[model samples]
Target: MTDDTNCIEVVTLTPLAQRFSYRCRTPLPEPGCRVHVPFGRGERIAIVTGSSPCPEGVQIKDVRTVLDQQPLLPKALQALLEFGSNYYHYPLGGAWATALPARLCQGEPLPTPKPELWKLRSDATLPQSGWGLRQSELLQRLRRGNLRMTELGSGDRQRIRQFLAAGWIEAARESPRLHETPLTLRPEQQQAVAAIRAACGFQPFLLDGVTSSGKTEVYLQSMEPLLLAGKQVLLLVPEIALIGQTYERCVQRFGATAVAVYHSGQGDAERLRVWERARSGSLSILLGTRSALFVPLARPGLLIVDEEHDPSYKQQSGWLYSARDLGLRRAQLEELPIVLASATPALESLYNRQCGRYADLRLRERASAQNIPQIEILPLRKKRLLGGLDPSLLSACAETLASGQQALFFLNRRGYAPALLCHDCGHVPHCRRCSAPLTWHRRQARLRCHHCGWEAPVPQRCPSCGGDGMNGIGMGTEGLEQFLQERFPNIPILRVDRDEVHTPRQLAERLQAIRSTRPAILLGTQMLSKGHHFPDVTLVGIVDVDQGLYSADFRAGERLAQTVIQVAGRSGRGDAPGRVLLQSHLPEHPLLLALQSGDYGTAAAQLLRERQQAGLPPLRALALLQAEAQRVEPVYAFLHAAQEYFQGSLDCSGPVPALLERRAGFHRAYLWLESTSRPLLQQVLGASMPQIPSLPGARRVRWSLDVDPQNF
Candidate 1:
């Protein structure tokens, strides 16, 4: 280390690359200090990771100015970030942008918390007369003990207002106490908790409990020992919607001040505050989505990933990192124990368990002793359907509603209609730039492409033949909503889909309304499925299950099985028994039969055998290099050159048309790269990516490499 002043030169953190570098400036603070620097004619905020001698004879820019008076990120988080950048093949600076909150990245100052308190006056005493019934109850409770300011109810507020005006009660300064009572756990839950508590140090435990088997209770119990040891805990959920529910439960055990939420939904200021709180050791528990894995804890001891198999845990955009994978890695690095809680574990996780990479802990029986929902298959080929609902499903919904219970209709598609067909000429409206049909959006009076987000007016005549006789074809969530509205004119019907509910607040409000009013029917897409608990939902109808079974993607069957199970799990959560009616053209399909019998183990075994024989994921590592250009030949030429570059180490296939070959005026083509070992594939990609980008026709097209792609 040099002198404090001349020790560091210019320190800069670039958002474009997420790299932290230092140049000789006058004198600078220590590494980890935040500074402002001149970057491309604009000043941006950056952190100093280190100070080193400027490279001789190389042009160097001096540090502009220092931003934070103190260091923002500690050494541990810096190491983790460096690991993530190299592992994900993403820019270091870009990873930091993802790790830090938006406000901090934009150079906002940290906030000072304004703490408030409530106290009873010295002369305050139990009311002897002239108190309203509600006020009297509140006064009696307060007489028994001291009450915090924020904890006062409306009745207490009214009485307090009177007392304050009369100078009979006074407010005092005290620390905030925002704690609630924990729920009573069942015996099985207690046993699961005890077993998890007995484990120590860097252990991997899988909590394979049935839906509502009190898996969360096991998590809470396992977390207690870690927290008691003064260690921080990180809880990862699949979506932001889950954060609220899980956060509430955590607050009930550990006070509100101990837990903080991190997600994209929060405003910049709130996110920055939470970030500071987590970093400063003001918060002990952190709950969030996949990105939460990057949170910098003061002392991380335990990492819990709830619903470990959910695909949402794997971020498809940007860095393309899997949160579940990172959780395991982070736990190992920190020498901490991790709990992966899931009803149906992913194949990769199951493989890990089989290979002794993780310890298995099964909560085989339901904690509450509730029976699983009855699953009935309705063969669509033999039954006449009305607006996607079969007679049996409709009858079930009617019976459920009549008994004062709720019903849910699951249709994965969301637009009003899937396609518009011309009756006169047998023509269909297709997206002008993509090889796919344009969906009709009745509310918007336009045909929209879900993939490229292209929209156009609903033409009165077919473009091919100028025919006026056209009709909307196939059922979607919107169409189903219309059908249910007309059929049940007197009952309230709530449609929960991407189009209807766009925000977490909207989804929460709709769910709350459904819970309060148990007689309504919920008609929507798979958005209504996954993780929501509706105790009064006695009936669930799967509108069309055949689409998943016939999709070109190899993982379609697995996805369909997971989705069917998740949707069925939503029913019969309470004491009232529930039923599920699945409508499919292939009712006798092996996957469907396995699902109906509640035999996920058998289904997974069969799928694993098939995957092994076919050389799919978990057996081989795969990557996809996609290229798109205005003309199709350019993509082919680029791919051909790429194929020539990787001569022997890797297997190259497919310069074929992508699933949707044309999109937004571009023709797309993909080349598949596969290897039995991950290291070999990484090496091939590392060597070939730079060369492929500079090939002929490369300048005229856009390309990206997707490692472990979920969709083709």
Candidate 2:
């Protein structure tokens, strides 16, 4: 017989077919609480998913402890996870792992954050006259009065450490709350704010604004009314690089105590603290990257997705999922208002707006009253270029720098050269693991694969012809940075790329340098675009943009348009009017011409028509069954099994090799299923997929299903 009172269902970070039933000493712990439950060899930390009935003849072990005062993930978020896991076709274990911080997964206790107070110790003697400048200055600051450590900035960490170690300072716990002055909203911004404030239940709004249109200010103002009502808000940005600046802006307006920033870059302890603030109902706002979507909210009143079109929102590896899609699902589940703000909104969101699923909020003018940058396309045909730099562009950059202003060179690609070619044999070095050419990185003095992160030292000569005719081909951010440095010797060139800025602190430092008011050049990959606010950068030059026009990927045009708009928007944010020089071999491409219209509405309409005709996403649903194995035959067999099972209902493509046929030594192939009817597609998946694992060749290879696949 089943012991209903003693049995509880627990979920761990394991790919289980279903939740396990465990015996508990007391009344089943709250459904969302963290419990230490016995697994194979040891105890594993797990979320108590729900109650269960003990099965006959089963020996279930008792849970050791309930680690939370309450459920870490509340009922609302739990419902969200359930829906997202099923929708994305991700395992419940992996989905939940993504929800909580790494520390919480190790069966450790989620701690309560103590109030931080620092005071000069009562037993400490006055420092002698021999103190160094750093110690001396720190002591002087401490002598003023007891200080709250929260008031300290980034520069104060080292000093605070020294003081605490020397017994010159002591910390005490104190409860605190905070407030800050709000910026005045313009008339149009007020209207947008009014609309957001009036949102009652399950409302989704698209804050469609141009660059420097003060959309952020609107986001802040809209949050104000909700914060005053003691409600929490979630603000999601596309990248970790943006979190520091956004955090600074939020802390300045809401006060540090009211705002919390969470991301993977943060240490486990720091992430846990942010989670504690969010869960305790003390934080008014939680701002961070995609994973921030899962942070538990006690009173989530609104959800805001900044740069909603960004590709980073889609997790390409390990339980591929889209945060933007989940955000909408969460809002609908909670019946809360959600505002997806984007200077260049995603086509999916645009399609929804066209179909009346989302209300559109537009901010057309620049917030500073500066005119949008005048864009001039410089054709790369038959022009005398100085190391890939058109003389005209250089002259403009010289003028901008001489006038004590900044110029930003935007290149989406990183490394020194995109490829290394053997002129003698016409051979190119390619990654052994992936079917892609290796890029030559000059600074690292190596050839690297951008796709799979494979790298090797540059060869002495061509491996094919042995002619010593190896030549660097194509331009990248490194090549642009080097050329700019040689031409503009006096001005400082700050190169911001993945290679240069690995941490958030590095990003913050580079941003700080740009704000110095000195004339300097900013060079980088897509990282320099969109998120940053560079006021004095009056001249913006896109060294390379021709590549995105005709990519194999269908989303290329939309992504390229967003990048162009965002990169150009970074300039002219200050009092000075900005100018953008775009270099392209094909100057009059329809997509490029459409950009002159300013907003993406016209281009979006065009793309939508094309997508509808072609039966793509937003008009149709897609699921990619990707299979990989050391040997390729099993992959094909497994996918063939899946295709045969779905048979006539869903249209399946491939069992063809992937774009990069082999990645990390595994040959990959994808089976794509598309359908105009979503329910029919879901029904087909629900009907026959459970039996595939036990089928022939299924165990010989690793495979996953990506529902609504964002990438190939």
Maximum-lDDT candidate: 2
Number of clashes in model 2?
Answer: 0
Task: Give all TM-scores, in the order shown.
Answer: 0.87, 0.90
Question: Which digits, one per residue and each the tens of the lDDT, describe model 1 over residues 1-712?
Answer: 2223343533234424435344545556666566777677877777676666655555556676676766666666667766776666666666676777777777777666432234456666645688788866766665666566577767667677776777665654332232544456766677767766776778888777767677876787677767756678899989887776787778887777667898888888778777776675666789988878877787777889998988888776666667888788778777778899887778777777878888887866655446777579998886668876788788888898899899999999989999899999989888878889999999889899988888899998888899898888998888888889888887899899888999999988987888799699988776777767778888889888897887878888788877888888778888887788999889889888888855466677777787889998877888887899989888898888777767587988878788788988899998888999999898777766657657776777777777877766
lDDT of 2 by residue, 157-213 (tens): 677887778777786522223356667777889899999999999999999998888
Local distance difference test, per candidate? 0.76, 0.84
lDDT of 2: 0.84
- Span of 10 residues, lowest total lDDT, candidate 2: 171-180
**What stretches of model 1 exceed 4 Å from their correct place?**
1-22, 26-32, 69-71, 112-188, 687-692
Model 2, residue 379: what's the lDDT? 90
Q: Which pairs clash (backbone N, Cα, C closer than 3 Å) in model 2?
A: none
Provide backbone clash counts, one per model: 9, 0
